[model samples]
Target: MLHILGLTANFSLTLQHKDQDILNVMSLVESTKRELQKLRDDGWDSLMAKVASFCKKHNVEMLIMEENFVDLRNPRKRTNISNMHHYKVNCFCTVLDFQIQEFKDRFTEVTTDLLICMAALSPIDSFHGFDKDKPVRLAKLYPDDFSYGELLSLEQQLDIYIDNIRRDERFKSVENLGDFSCLMVKTQKHLAHPLVYKFLKLVLILPVATASVERCFSAIKLVKTAARNRIGDQFLSDCMVCFIEKELFDSISNEKVIKKFQMMNERRVVL
Candidate 1:
C-alpha cells in the first residue's frame, strides 16, 4: 500500500508542467505505463502468497492469532478466509487500473494540440522539432486575430523569424516563453512573427497548474484581509496584479513610476 502511494505521488509530479515540453509529457506517460505493467505482471497476489507462506512456516500466523493481529470475523461475513490477502490484492489491482484509466482519460491525443503548439516555441536544439502547422492551427482557432492572408504571411514571417533567432547569439539560452518574449521585445522582432507571438502569448498564459489559481486566491486573501476588506474592486485588482507579478513590478524604476504618476495628474511632488 505504501509502495502504491509513493508511485501515485511520483505520477502526480510527472503531470506537473513547469518548463515541460510535449515530448516530456509523452515520455512520462510511457514510463508510467511501463511501471504499472510491471506492477501488474509482478502481481500483488504473488507477494501475498509468499508472505502467507513465510508466516505459516514460521508459525507467525499462530502468534498473530493469539495477539489478535487481524480481525478474523468479517463484518459482512462474505468470506471464510482467515486472512483477507486475496481481497486486498484485488483492491490493489482495481486502484492501479483506475489510476491508469484516469491518466489516459485526462491526457488523450486531442488534449495534446495545445502542448504541441507550446513546444514549438522552445528555444533549444535550434527549434529543430518546431511545427509550423501546429501554430497555424492554433492561429486558426482565433479567426479574429488571423485572416487567411495574415496566416500565410505569418508562415513566411515564422520562417524568417526562426532563421534570424537561430543565428542570433542572444537567444541561444532562452528556455521559457517569458524569457523568449523579453528577447523578442529587446530585439524588436515581435512584429516579425505576429501570429507566432500571439500563439506563444496564449501558451504562456495557459494555466500550467491549478496551484497558480490557488496562489492568486491566497494573494487575494492576504491583500484583502479584514483591515482592507472595503477596498474598491479596481484597487483590489491593482493590488493583486502587483502581488502576483511582483518580479515585474520590482523591475520598474521608481523614477518611471513617479513620472507616470505625475503625468496622470496636473500637480506632482518632486522626488
Candidate 2:
C-alpha cells in the first residue's frame, strides 16, 4: 500500500486469500519499511520500483496518489534550524522556484510522445488545520503553474466536473449513479479511483481483518537475534523478503488436525 502524506491518501494491495492472513501481513510490513526508506533516499523513482516489486510478489495491483501541488506541501512547507554544541542543522522543504527550473529540465529529457501529469497550485491542507508557515518559493522538479488564490474545495470542483461528464451520451442508463452517495458517511471514501471504492465496499462487508499483516511483523521481531541488537535496515529487509514470499498454512486443511484430536478420544467417538 502506498500511504501518501499521512492518512490523507493511500493505496492498498490485495491478494484473494481464504484463510491464511499471517503471510500477507508479514509481506505488508516488510514492503512498507522498504518503501519508506527508499522514498527518503531516492524520491518518486525509487518509490515506484518498490511499489512494483511488492505488487508482483503478492500477485496484487497498485494505485498511486497524485501528490500534486494542491495536496503535497507546496508553498507551506515547514523549516527549522537546530544547533549542536559546534554544529548546526538547517532543514527546509524543497522550495518552488528551484523546483520549477528542475521540472522544465525534466520535460526536456523525457522521450514520451504524451506526458500527462496532474497539476494544481494550492495550499497543502486548507480544509482542516490552521498552519502558520506561509511559503514564498518551493522546490519544483516539474513545470507547474503556481497560482495562489481562494480555491474551490475538492468536493465542489468534482461536483461540477461530474455534472459536465454525466451529460455526455456515453452514460445512457446509469445517469443517477453519478449522484449515488450517502454523504453523511463521513469516513473518507477515496472516490478518486472507482476501484478503490469497489475494494473498500468488499472489505467493509467481509469478516476478515488485517490480523495477518500483524502476525508477520510479530514474526519479524522474533526473528531478530541479540547479535542484531537494534533490528537495523538490513535485517528488517531480509525478514520481510523471506516472510512475504512464503506460503502460509491453509486454514481449511485443518480438518486433519481436527480429526486427529477427535480420534485421540477413543472412548467417545460420536458419529
Candidate 3:
C-alpha cells in the first residue's frame, strides 16, 4: 500500500495543477500507466525491502514467510498457502493488479488517442504544441461536426492558420489556450480559421483535466450534506453553481437580485 501510494502521488500532484492543459494531462496519464505497469512487473523485491525496513524501524515482528499461513479464527478450514504467497500474491500483487486494471479500464486506447489528438490544439509556447496532422485527425474523430468537405478545408486552413498566427505580433503574448482563444477572437483570426477555431473550441470544452470536476464534486459534499439530502436536483444545481462561482455572484448587488426575483412573478408586497 505504501509503495502504491507513493507511485500514485505524482498522479495526484499532476491532477491538482490548476494550469495543466489537456496535452500535459494526457501525457501524464500515459506515463503514469506505464510507471504503474513497470512497478507491477519488476517492483516486488524493492517493495518488500521497503516494507521490511519500515517493520524493523517500528519494532514489528517479521513473519516467517515460508511457514503455512493459517487463519486463527477459522482453524478448521485447512488452507495450504505459505505466508510469502499470502503477502506477495494475495496482497501486494493483488493491489497492484487492481490498480493496473483500473488505469487500463479508464484510459483505453481509443480514449488515449482521442486525448492525444486533442493535445494538438494546445496553444502553449507560441503554438509550439500545434500539429497539423493531429488536428485533422481530431476533426475525423467527430464526423458529425466535420463533414467530408470541411475536413478537406480544415487541412488547407491549418496551413494558413499556423503561418498567420505564428507571424501575428498580437498572439505572441498569448500564454494558455484560453488566452490564445480570446486573442484569436479579438483579432478576428477565428473568423479567418473557422475550422481550426471550431477544433480549438472542442478542445476547450473537453473535460480532459480533472481539477474543475474535482472542485465541483468537493463542493457537492459541502452543498448536499445529510442535513440537506432532500434538496431537489434543480435547487441543488443552483446552490452548487452559486457555491462554485461565489466570486462572480458576490459582485452582483442584492438590489439587482431582488429586482431580478421581482420580475420572475407578480407579488403582493414590493420591497
Best candidate according to lDDT: 3
Residue-level lDDT tens digits of model 3 in 1-271: 7668888898878878767666677778878878888887898889778879989999999888899998889978876999889888998789989998888898888888888887776666777878889888878988999999999999999999998988888877777778888888988988888888898888788765468678988899999999998999999999999998988999999999999999999999986
The C-alpha lDDT values of all candidates are 0.72, 0.37, 0.84
- Lowest lDDT sum, 10 consecutive residues, model 2, at 112-121
Superposition error at 169 for model 3 (Å): 1.4
lDDT of 2 by residue, 134-251 (tens): 1111111112322232122322344443444345443333212112222212323344423223322332333333446556667776677687678778868877766665665343
Q: What is the C-alpha RMSD of each candidate to the true structure, in Å?
A: 6.9, 23.6, 4.6
Instruction: Summing lDDT over every window of 10 consecutive residues in candidate 3, give the lowest-scoring window.
Output: 205-214
- TM-score, one value per model: 0.65, 0.20, 0.79
- Report the C-alpha lDDT of model 1 over 1-271, residue by residue, as the tens digit: 6666666676666554334556677667667777776776686767577778988898875233222224457554544343444444456677778777876787776565656666776777767777777777777777787888988887787788788888998888877668889888888878766666776787777645545566788898899999997999999999899999988889999999988878887884564
Ranking by TM-score: 3, 1, 2
In model 1, where do residues sit more than 4 Å from their true spots? 14-18, 53-90, 140-145, 208-214, 218-271
Who is ahead in TM-score, 2 or 3? 3
Of the two candidates 1 and 3, the one with more favorable lDDT, higher being better, is: 3
